[model samples]
Target: MLKKIDRAAAFIQKESELFRCPMCHQQLTAKEKSLVCSNGHRFDLSKKGTPYFLKHQVQTDYNQAMFQHRRKLIMNGMYQPLIDVLTPYCEGERILDVGCGEGSFLSQLATSAQLKPSVGFDISKEGIYLASDYGENLFWCVADLTNLPFQMGSFTRVLNIFSPSNYQEFKRVLVPGGKVIKVVPGSEYLKELRQAFYPEDETKQHYSNEAVIDKFQETFTKITRKTLKYTFDIPENCRLSLLEMSPLEWGVSPENKAQVQKNPLKQITIDLEILIGEFL
Candidate 1:
C-alpha cells in the first residue's frame, strides 16, 4: 500500500506543476510518504493511500454507509448515461474531480476517457479512504474545495459532478483552454424518491436549474448544455441501497422511509443537465 501511494505521489509531482501549499501557496514537493512545501506545511499519506490536504477537520453527513451504497449503485450502471455524456470533455492528460465522493464517478470517467493521472479530492475523510481502497490508478486526497492544494492552471480537465462549484478555484486550477464539465440535477431527477418522501409538498415534486445555469454562464465564456433524461428500472433488491444513497432521505421520518421501502418504485427518473464550459 505504501509503495502504491508513493507511485501516486510521484505521478502527481511529475504530471502537473500546479500542486501548491494550501497555507503558503508554495510549490509542494512529494517525498516517500508525504508532501511538503517551502514554508514547511506537510501533509502525510494515510494508510489507505490517500493524502491529507485539509488544514482542519470537517464534519459531513456523507458517511461511509451512504458512500458504500452509492458505490454499489454506480457500479450497477446507474450513472452510465451521465458518464457517456461526460467522457468527451475529459480529453486532457490531467483531470481533477472537485468534491468527488468516493471517487467512483471520476474513476469511471478516467477509464472511459482513457485519461492519465486522474485525481480526486473531497472534504470527507471516509470518502477519500473508500476511494483509495476501491479505485485503481487514481490519486485520492482529503482537501477543501475553496482552498485546493494545487498550483494555478495545473489541470487540463476539471469535473464537478453533483458537487458544489467553486468557480474561482476551478478557473485557477485549469490550464488555458481547459474545460470544466459540471453535472447538475434537473427537474425529475429522483422525482420518485422526492415524491415518496414528501408526497404532499408541491415544491418537492419539482426542481429548477435556472440559478445554477445562469451562474455557470456568468462564469464561463463558451458554454454548452445537454440534458439527459431517462428512466431506469430499479432492481428489487437495490431499492434500499438507492434510498440510502440519497441525501433527500436524510431528514425524513422513519415511518416515511419505511413507507418508501415497502412500496418502492419499480422505475426512477434520471434527469440531469451536463454543462461544458471553458474560461472566458
Candidate 2:
C-alpha cells in the first residue's frame, strides 16, 4: 500500500507544478519540493507526494474514515455516468472543479478526456489528499469556495458536483467564453436514504429549480439542463461510509441510523440534474 501511495504522490508532485496560489493569485515558487508564494505563504508537498496548500482550516464533524470509505464506493464507477455528461464540455481546456470532494469525478474527467490542466479545490484536507491518490495530473488545493484564489477568467470550464454551488465567485474565475456545469440532487435522489432519515419526505422542498435558474440567468447566456439517473447495488460494508458522506448524517438521529442499518438497500439511486451554461 505504501509503494502504491508513493507512486501516487510522485504523480501529484509533477502535477503541482502547473498551479499557482489560487487565492493570492500569485506565482508559486518551488523550494525544496514545496510550493511558496512571494507574500511568505508556504505550502509543503506531502510525503505521499501531493501539494498541501490550504491556508485556512474549518473544523467539521465529518470524520475522515467516512470519506475514505466513500472513496472506495466512488472508485467503483457508481458516479461514472455523471462524468460522461461532464466530459463533453471539458475537452481541450483548463478545467476547475469547485468543491471537488475526494477528487473522484475530476480525476475521472482528467484521465478520460483530452482536457489539459485539470485542477480541483476543496476545503477538506482529506478529500484533496484522496483525490491526489487517484491521478497525478490533477492540481488539487485546499481553498475556500467563497474566496477562490485563482485569477479572474482563468478557467474554461468549472465542475460542481454534489457539492454546494457558489455562483458569484464561480462566474468571476471563468473566462468570457467559459462554462459552469452544476449538478444538483433531484427530488427523488436517494429516496431510499431519505426514507431512513425524514418521516414526511418534506425535506425535498429545499431543492429549488427556480434558484438554479435565477443563478444561471444572472451569469450565463445559453443555459441547458438535463437529468440523469442510474441504479446500482451497494455492498453492506460501504453502507456506513455512504451514510457518513451525506447530509443525512447530520439530519438523521441515532434512532434513524439504527433504522437505516436494519436494511440499507434496494437499489442505490444516482438521480441528478446537470445544468450547463455558457458565460455571457
Give RMSD to native, each candidate.
1.7, 3.3
lDDT of 1 at 261: 84
Residue 73 shift from truth in candidate 2, angstroms? 2.3
TM-score of every model versus the real structure = 0.95, 0.83
* Candidate 2 residue runs with Cα over 4 Å from true position: 1-24, 50-54, 204-209, 235-237
> Per-residue lDDT for 72-187 in model 2, tens only?
78777667888777777777778888888787778777777777767787787777777766654566667778777666776888888777778788887888878888888776
Candidate 1 wrong stretches, greater than 4 Å:
1-7, 10-16, 134-136
Among all windows of ten consecutive residues in candidate 2, which has the lowest summed lDDT? 3-12
The 10-residue segment with the lowest total lDDT in model 1: 9-18
Q: lDDT at 127 for candidate 1?
A: 89
Report lDDT per candidate.
0.83, 0.71
